[model samples]
Target: MSLAERLVRLPDPRRRRGVRHPFVAVLLIAASAVAAGARSYAAIGQWARSAPQQTLARLGARLLTSLNVRIAPSGSTIRRIVSTVCPGGLADLMGEAPTGAPAVAVDGKSARGSRTDTALAAHLLSAVTATGRVVSQLRVPDKTNEISTFTALLAPFDLTGTVVTADALHTQREHAKWLVEVKKAHYLLVVKCNQPNLHAAVRALPWQEVTARRYDRGRGHGRRETRSVRTLTVTGLGLDFPHVVQAVKILRHRTNVKSGKVTRQIVYAITDMTAREASPQFIGRIARSQWGIEAVHHVRDTTFAEDASQIRTGYGPENMATLRNLAINRLREHGHTSIAAGLREMSYEPFTRPLDLLGVAP
Candidate 1:
């Protein structure tokens, strides 16, 4: 079925008199606006007002049948509907991969300046895939730790057969134990200053004392460098927390060309998976892929102009963010060579035609 159809199938939370079915019209409007570069409500409203009839017809329904343009609802209405639904429901709609360990990365982003009265930002926790698909998201109450948000965000999904990765902020003992003991999923989390004992042990270990390999090279007006990392499973680190199967120290080196410059970067990671369960190379790759959240954030903020959005109040901000994610995932699923290019193409034409976007026949 089409994305529009699937979206329409989502349960509606409105009980007001003017409430309409969860028609694809609004979703189509939102998607087209996103594609055409309408990042804010006013811009989308303007786009909808410009060609009301055409847009409505494309959605297979008409909100404002008269004058070919109907009055669009206030942005507040949109936001309210978005916030009512559970984000996990939307995640399930994105589907899943058939094979291989599903790489799931959890990270948080702050919508700075989203609130008017105070400087308090909206902290959003998102679960995304390696290819930058946002599976789900949650809005944490201000003053709460990400650990509190992490468990709730993970509750709805099946972590089995999945490899969950997160940064040091989410590397709590309980978090690791929950993912393994409760969810039966493997976890790859970074160990940083926050975990004092774990951090000190990872640091105090005879790291350089262990045999390691270093690789380096040079390029245009600059030099290049690489370090082949290896790790030996060590026990008795005296960690106060539980479920820490092993600790790993990753050594990295870099060189500059224009000027003969040398730099070294070292990282430490902790995981419940042991050497018998996971190899050093596997750990390295998982740790590296944790940055997928960065790429996802970059695309949402830069390509989609999420940070520049002026949406505030009610559900507008959250709903719009979800729409951007939906648009991104759809474009990626279709094998679009470039998300920016795909969005641009969708903006100039009709959006109700899901088959066209999916490169399928009607």
Candidate 2:
């Protein structure tokens, strides 16, 4: 079946009037609002009312025979209908992933302004793919951590044959065990201060004692900076750690010029992959992927103006953030030459017209 047909087949809770056309209208409005950079209900209403009536005419072909195409839904009416449907139901309709995807990263972000006089700040956990699509998400109270929300967020999707990665905050023994033992998925987690013994042992490895050396250099600001990294892989270290197949030490030395003076800094990382499984190139790539969460957050905050959204109601902030994610993924899927260019094009006047530029019909 076609994309619209698959979408309409998904469950929606708001069936009060036995009219399906209005429901499809609301879905179309929501999709267009996200494409045009309307992140909240109010902005969506404004866009819907301001849109030319012809913009929705195509949806008539998709409606059931019993439903009339002449009927139009008011902004408030669409909002109420949309708000009544469960977020998970809507996400299912939007396509999480096709089969055979490799990895899914779980991370959390706090909506900086979504706090109330009586409620705690809103925190969200999103399961995003490696190519930067948010597959699914869940919201938790401010007092809880990502671990508290991980299982619930992961419950709805298939996890077999996929690798789950997260920052050190979620590198708990139980979390790792659950991903490996319960979910039957491999895990690549960052080791940090939270696991004191693992951190110390990985830090104390005989990196200096090993005989391996690698150096890389690049130019910036008309000056040259050189970095040297050495790796030492040790097995049978007599360290008891959970889900740790092998331990490694990475020593990085950087020399840069600041105000005509040179400076240096060192950093390290610990992983569950063995030296055999994780070559120098492999480790470097994985380390870089850790910043995927940062990229998602940066786009949401700056390009989408997420910080400026004043949605501070019950679950409103979290839900709007999810919409922003949906918008980002949809834009990425449509093959924008670059995300910045995509955002700039969407920010222009008559934003809806640019859908044709991206090969998407209204």
Candidate 3:
């Protein structure tokens, strides 16, 4: 379905009285404005005002029959709609993860600008696909952490046949069992010091004796890094962890091409899939998928200016983040790797090219 039609699914938080714009129109304008590089409500309002009458009409802008004039929703109205809309619904409507079998990465990010003296910044746990599309996100309530909100963040989607990848924070025995047994999905969870027994057991594996099963090198941004992955089957072993089929150890070495500095780090991960089901290289690749969400976080901050946004009223922060995700995901899907450049192309003089991305029929 078109994003405009999908937006109608968002719960209307406004009452019927004094509603100046169509619900879909208001949201469509907000989304279009953001896609055309509007960062905040003020920018959205300005973009709406400068928009052509026909553009507004196609975006569902209301027509004043008395004067035959089409006017955009006011900034305050847009702010109200954005701040009250359901974030989860918005994320899904903005091109969510495909249900078949893509690898999904779970991570959390904090909107630093939302922090106040009385309350901490809003931290959201997000599930992002391998291609950097944010499929699901939920706020971690004040005084709570992602670990507690993990299940709730993933509750909305059908994840069967999905390989869920996450850091050590989500390595709980119950979570693993739920993903494997209940959700009918697989988990590739990193092992860390937080889970002492699992961490020690993974560390004690005869990794030195097992040759590295996978090798890789990365060169970019003034540094070169090499990595190797070694896998060992531990299903028959008397491990305390749930449904452990393979234990993986990844060792990474980084050398600063400019400074001649070298650094090394190692990480271990456990997956429910047996070696036959998932090769050692596949395990390493899926484990690396966690960076997709990290890249999303970076793009939000650097490209979309998410960390700098001061929107903290109601659901404003999360809603704006979802809009940013929409912009980036749409551009990426259309083969625009440079989000900033794609947004520049979107902000054309006619202000109509970005509408094509929204599936607006000419």
Candidate 4:
């Protein structure tokens, strides 16, 4: 029923002998420390060591040291265990969306700190729900890009009736066909130069004559922006896009309140849903939800300082990223608006709060 119970179900990747700390306890402790704002192995170990005996007991951390006292795993041990644990299994356990037609926004991010002069940074593709929950995440291979990894990122979920949104990079006909035919899901994919014919066709539509339209205006972060969306039934458009039933064009006009500078851009997209299935208003909301993945990535970079971390060794980067996602989701679920503030509160004395969040057992 608790997170630790679910975590204990994962197979330990370590050897059978000479293990002091229970593998489940080590994993639970690491995840709890990360949720409490420990950004690195050293910080995680420090948090474990500084935890009160009651908190450690709740986390199932009863490993005894030479001094004949129960203790947490050392920094090196925590690092090794995390690095070797199965990332996909961990993600599958931590990432689960609520039932219904959830809006899934897929996006990719590169960890700047993991890059070297000779090698590119670790690129990860993530599927995030509209409510800012991570549904899944997978690392793109060193030899490939997001487009190549997009389908795999989506393969784990049973996406029936779900709306999966992605940027222009994943607007290929193959992706559309796969989503519609194989997954039985709908797609709201951005059209751009990547799909030249599809882009031109959607752009050339008589959007002004479309019967369905929606407009919205908002001010935030020192800028005022207006968005106008036009939707047209694609049945008569004579476009060759796969399973396309509607085409959309969104025009955004922005003005910087501080600089008085103005800019405008138009975005095109094709969706499997008909004009009736996805009204103009619903389209507008779903389009905005496409940025949810960006919000998740932004928090990891800014709040957790993920881009500044120097952890690049063996599964370390991906493993750390998984824990960071879990932490962010937990904080948001617990009604913490600001991740940094949540970390500070959890990091205060008597560290039992983190254990409580982790559903640790007494």
Candidate 5:
């Protein structure tokens, strides 16, 4: 079924007394507008007003009194529908990934523009695959944090045999145990000063004599970085966390090509993979893939203007964010790496371009 057909499963939140626009149609317009570079609610409304009748019709909009025209929902109507629709339902609809995601990264992003004195911004915890597919997302509840919401964010997916990676903040003993025992998944967690003992032990491993298990060098944005990694089996290390296998230490040297200034840094990571199961190279790749979610956040904030969006009311901010990610994932699926360029192309041919993205025919 097409995306429009699938969206009809969501229950409409509005009253039937005086409803004008179809809920699914309004959602389609909102999604298509975001895909076409509509940065704000006003822009979304404007896009609806200017959309071609055939495009609107294909997206489920109704016929108007004139046969050649379609009724576009007003800005307020679109805002209300979008802000009231269940974010969880929309997230499910938008987050469709293929089976067998080997490595998944969990991270959190706060909508900075939604901050107010009455409440903090909308903070959402998301699970994304190594290839930039957002599998799921959940809102971190008020007065709570991502640590408390991590399990909820990842609970819906079948994670058996998948390697889940997260930043140090999510490296709790309970989380590690749950991922291993409950989900039947492996975990690669970074160890920072947050867990003092584990960090100290990982730092204390004898490494001068150990050969480099992995080496990678790359240059980007006028800077060059070289990474050397070594691994140690910590099965009997008596660590505080549950399940033990390997510990990793990495040294990074970064240099500025123009100024010839060099800087060095160290990082530590832990994983449940044994030497036979996952080599140092696999661990390093999964470690690097953890930043894929960060890249998605950067794209949302920079290309989609997510951080600048001021839709702070109700579910509006998070729903808008889901649409933004939908656009990014759509563009990536269509073989566009540059989201800015994709937006321009979609907008240049607004009538058919956005519909093509929405899986609608015109």
Candidate 6:
């Protein structure tokens, strides 16, 4: 189904009587506007009003006055419907990924714009694929945090044969067991000071004897970096972690090209993936792929200005975040590597361009 069709499947929370705008149209407009670089409700409403009559009709936008004179939903209408719509349902509708041994990175981010006196910024845990597809997301409830919400965020996914990677905060024994024993999936969890014994044990393993090792180097943005990863099969180490067949250590050496400044650090992780199931090179790739979640957040904050937005009331922040995710995924699907440029291009012709993103182009 098309993106519009997928959006229309969400249950509308608005009352029926005297409704001037269709909820689906409001959502579609908001999504398209965000995809086209409209950051706030006012910008979304402006984009909707500026859309061509033919484009609005193709998006199934309701007629506020007459068929001959097309009108778009105002900022309030868009914000109401968008904030009230279920974020999880929208994510399920848009987060359709193919089956494979995909590397899924689980991470959390806080919307700085949502901060208020009574509450802190909105914290959300998201599972993103290595290719930058958002598989699922859940808001970290008030009085709680990401560690408490990690398992629940992953419950809706079919994780069989997938390698799930997470930071040290989620490196709990129960989570590791659940991923391996219950979900039939593999896990590569980082070990840090949070789990002292595991970190020490993993760090103490004799990695030099391991035959499987990998090295990679890259240069970009005025920096040169080298990464080396070594994997060792842990046998009888008596570690408390469950189903850990191998441990890995990644050493990163980075230098500033201009300033000649150098920095080096070592990171550790334990995984159920055997040396045969995933070579050291593959493990290195999965380890590096964990940054994909950060990339998604970066786009939302910088390109979409999600952190600077002031729409924190009700479900507005969550709803806007979901729409932003859809926008990014849509652009990526269309082969746009640079989100800023894509948004700028769409911003130039908001009236006609959004139709293509809505899959309602004539």
| Winning model by TM-score | 3
Which segments of candidate 4 are over 4 A away from where they belong?
65-68
Candidate 1: residue 289 lDDT (0-100): 65
* Tens digit of per-residue lDDT, candidate 2, span 220-301: 5445666555555554676555566654444443344555556665545544556666666555544445557678888888
Model 3 has a clash total of 0
Query: Which 10-residue window of candidate 5 scores lowest in summed lDDT?
Result: 60-69
The TM-score obtained by model 3 is 0.97
Query: TM-scores for all candidates?
Result: 0.82, 0.80, 0.97, 0.95, 0.95, 0.95
- Model 3 segments beyond 4 Å from truth? none
User: On a 0 to 100 scale, what is the lDDT of residue 138 in model 4?
Assistant: 84
Worst 10 residues of 6 by lDDT: 92-101
CA lDDT for candidate 2: 0.64
lDDT of 5 by residue, 1-362 (tens): 87787788999999999987888899999999999999888999999999877788887786666665688888899999889999888887888563598899999999999998898999988888888878777788999889998987777777899999999999899999999999999999999999999898888877776663999898976999998878888788676668868888878899999999999988888888888877878888888779778998989899887888888998998899888888888888899988899999998988789889868766
**Candidate 4: clashing pairs of residues:** none
Ranking of predictions according to lDDT = 5, 3, 4, 6, 1, 2
Q: Candidate 4's residue-wise lDDT over 230-306, tens digit each? A: 89988976999889999989999999999999999999988999877898888889998896678788899988999
Question: In model 2, which runs have C-alpha deviations exceeding 4 angstroms?
Answer: 1-3, 15-21, 60-72, 92-99, 210-235, 248-269, 347-362
User: In model 4, how large is the Cα lDDT of residue 46?
Assistant: 93
Tens-place lDDT per residue, model 6, 162-274, is: 99999999999999999998889999999999899889888878777777789999897699989998998885777667898889989999999999999999999999888
- Residue-pair clashes, model 2: 0
Residue 220 CA displacement from its true place in model 3, Å: 1.9
Q: How many clashes does the backbone of model 6 have? A: 0
